[model samples]
Target chain A: EAGVVQSPRYKIIEKKQPVAFWCNPISGHNTLYWYLQNLGQGPELLIRYENEEAVDDSQLPKDRFSAERLKGVDSTLKIQPAELGDSAVYLCASSRTVYNEQFFGPGTRLTVL
Target chain B: SQQGEEDPQALSIQEGENATMNCSYKTSINNLQWYRQNSGRGLVHLILIRSNEREKHSGRLRVTLDTSKKSSSLLITASRAADTASYFCATDSGATNKLIFGTGTLLAVQP
Candidate 1:
């Protein structure tokens, strides 16, 4: 089976611009997650979805960051008025269940100048 | 805030040698998992050990969890150059079951 897939493996945007990342989870997976990773650091959870409901998104920056999984299979994370500090890798992952092993996508490397 | 912290930010080893990395977390956890990420790539799950379990092995990887000490260690035996990557430990804690990752340890294996 194919693993989780993410679009636009790399993206470059200027500050104050808008940027979006897309993700397609593995077949039959019921949970999806979005994470932000900075240089020399591990990934931090931004949002998590169980089916079409965002079960955990307390860490997401509501002022600028938003994510949605309309059909429960694909998800999109958007950052509006991007800032210089927003430059980092945006990763998406999927799992069979909430407590199961997660499969990750090759992440979109976003650079905000 | 990261709940786990990995010791030795970086390590270098030669092929056929063994590598061990440690992780310490601050909260009570249901399970702890280890993952490997190649340079510029996504993470790949390595092993998972439950709080009730002590040690588990998969192929060349051995993971041990000490819930009492709130720490865990990963051992890769007879390492290969292909094992050159960053290793992370994530704790599954809280009611959300969200994984809180550690700062990761970069390992370089020389062939």
Candidate 2:
């Protein structure tokens, strides 16, 4: 089976521009997650979805960042009016359930200039 | 912060040698997992050890968890150049679906 799939492996945009990343989780996976990873640091959770419901998203920056997992399979994370500090890798992962090990996708590397 | 800290930020060793990395977390957890990520690539799950378990082995990877100490260690025996990557430990909060990840250990095995 294929692992999680993400589009636009890398992206470059200027500050104040909007950018979005897409993710397609593994088949049959019911739990999805979006994470932000900075240079020399580990990934930090942005949001999580159990099916179509976003069960946890307290870490997400509501003012600029938004994420949605539609039909509990595909997800999109968008950053509007992006900032230089938002340059980092955005990762998507999925699991069969909340208790299972997650499978990650090759993240989208955003470079805000 | 919910993130954990890893010891020996970097490791370089000859092929066939053993490489050990440690991770320390601050909260009680239901389980701990290890992940490996090649340069510029996504992370892959390595191993998972529950709080009730102390040691678990998969192939050449051996993971030991010390819930009492709130720490875990991952040992890769007979390492190879292909093992060059970053290793991270993640702790499950047990209450939420979130995982607190450690800073990560950069391992470079020379062939």
Candidate 3:
């Protein structure tokens, strides 16, 4: 079976522009997560999805960032009017159950100039 | 929010030596997991230790969790240059399935 997959491993856009990243979790995994990783720092949870419902999005920047897990199998994270601070690696991961070990994707490296 | 803190912001060791990193977390956790990240790319899950379990091993990796102290340790035996990377410890805290991660420890193995 394939591991989690992410698109556009590298992305560059100007500040105030819109950027989107895509992720496809592993098959049969019910829990999906999005995280932002800054230089020399660990990944921080942006949002979490349990199937089609987003159970937690407290860490997400609701004003400029929005995410969807349409069918729960795949998810997309969009940042409108992106800011310079948004330049970081966006990682997607999935697990078979809540609190279980997670598998991660290569991640989308976004550079906002 | 960040939940755990890893000590020894950086570690340098010769190949074939052992590397050990420690992590301390706040609040109770159902499980603790260790992950490795190369550069700024994605993270690879190394091992997971449940709250009830004290230790776990996989290949060259060994993880020990002590709920009494709310701390965990990861030991990599017979390390190789390929082991150079950033290691992190994460915890499952709330009911949202969200994982809180620590600052991380950078390990550089000299061949």
Candidate 4:
């Protein structure tokens, strides 16, 4: 069984530039999530998708951050005009359902200079 | 503020020794999970304990939860060099479908 997959393992962009990370969750998983982990800290949820519908996204910064799971299989997280504080690891995870254990993807490390 | 907080930010032990880490959280949760991460890669699920359950074991790993104190602990017996990594505890709060992770504990098992 293949694990969660993510692209662009590492990304470096200057402040005010835009960056986007992609994630493909495990097959047959119905719940997808996006999280941000800063240095020395744990992951914080940015958004959650239950079959292409965003069920929870309160923590996402509406002004600059956006995420979409078009078919509920793959997801994309975008940050426009990124700030230095946005530098962190972007993690994608998926579960069979809301209460199931999540499987994570190797995160995309974003560095905003 | 994170819902889960882990204690003993760092630990070091010999290969044959045991390593334990603790986690505390606020509010009620449906379940708690343990994960291991090597370097900056993805996390591997180690174990999960539901709220009603007190203790769970898998292979050489053990996890215990105390609902009254809103705390949990992970124990790895006879640790090996491959166990050198960061361990984290995540909570599944009742309201949200998301899991909030704790500040990890860095474990260095010397061979």
Residues A1-113 of candidate 4 have per-residue lDDT tens digits of 98899989999999999999999999999999898999888888999999999999999999999999987789999999899999999999999998788899999999999
TM-scores, all models, native as reference: 0.98, 0.98, 0.95, 0.97
Give Cα distance to truth, residue B7, candidate 4, Å.
Answer: 1.1
**Quality of candidate 3 docking, DockQ:** 0.73
* lDDT tens per residue, model 3, B1-111: 689899989999999999999999999988899999885555898888888999999999999999999999999999999999999999976554568899999999999
Instruction: Name the top DockQ candidate.
Output: 4
Clashing pairs in 3: none
Candidate 3 yields a Cα-based lDDT of 0.92
Report the CAPRI category for model 3. medium
| DockQ for each model | 0.82, 0.76, 0.73, 0.82
By summed lDDT, the worst window of 10 consecutive residues in model 1 chain A runs over: A97-106
Clashes of each: 0, 0, 0, 0
Residue-wise C-alpha lDDT for candidate 2, range B9-108, written one tens digit per residue: 9999999999999999998998999999986667999999999999999999999999889999999999999999999999997988579899999999
Docking class of 4: high
Chain A TM-score, structure 4 = 0.98
Report fnat for all candidates as fractions from 0 to 1: 0.81, 0.78, 0.89, 0.94
Model-by-model lDDT, in order?
0.95, 0.93, 0.92, 0.92
lDDT of 1 by residue, A18-94 (tens): 99999999999999999999998999999999999999999999999999999989999999989999999999999
Which one wins by TM-score: 3 or 4?
A: 4
lDDT of 3 by residue, A59-91 (tens): 999999999999879999999999999999999
Model 1 per-residue lDDT at B86: 96
